[model samples]
Target: MKFERLPFIMKNLIRYQATMKENDWNKGFDLLRSIEFQEGVYKTGPMFFSMEPAENEPRYRNFEFFMPVNFQVEGE
Candidate 1:
């Protein structure tokens, strides 16, 4: 198999982090949308998601969700 590396592009994003089990993975996303709605923010690009084993809780994972916005949000 062959693969090519893609260059990293810098982006401004609103980030939300949470720890939860796989069954509740969408919770973070829902919360992020709620915040976006409350703040009148719109997504400008794809949503980014990352996860790793939660500290001291093997059943859960620490997740970070990122939403790229059209412009930088103040007081972030």
Candidate 2:
């Protein structure tokens, strides 16, 4: 499994990272909206998770939905 830290709702808050197969992209988005989360501050464009190219790794040349969210947390 892959693991990485998702952005926080605010400073010093819990964060989660998840991925969906993307059958219905809106479903994933709707689920996020139904949860207690907030929008993260970022440049208004595609944010690539880039690294030095590897012969065994594939590149993501396109994305239909790319967003970052933070779960609302009451404590640090």
Best by lDDT: 1
Q: Report residue 73 deviation for candidate 2 (angstroms).
A: 2.2
Task: Give the clashing residue pairs of candidate 2, or none.
Answer: none
1-76 in candidate 2: lDDT tens per residue? 9999997433323332333332433453454344433444332233222123334435412223334433333422
Among all candidates shown, the one with the greatest TM-score: 1
- How would you encode candidate 1's per-residue C-alpha lDDT over 1-76 as one tens digit per residue? 9999999564668888888896788888887788777778888878778999998998999999888876777755
Q: What is the lDDT of every predicted structure here?
A: 0.81, 0.36
Tell me the TM-score of model 1: 0.79
What lDDT does candidate 2 reach at residue 66?
Answer: 32
Candidate 2: list runs displaced more than 4 Å: 1-21, 37-76
Give candidate 1 regions above 4 Å deviation.
1-3
TM-score of 2: 0.25
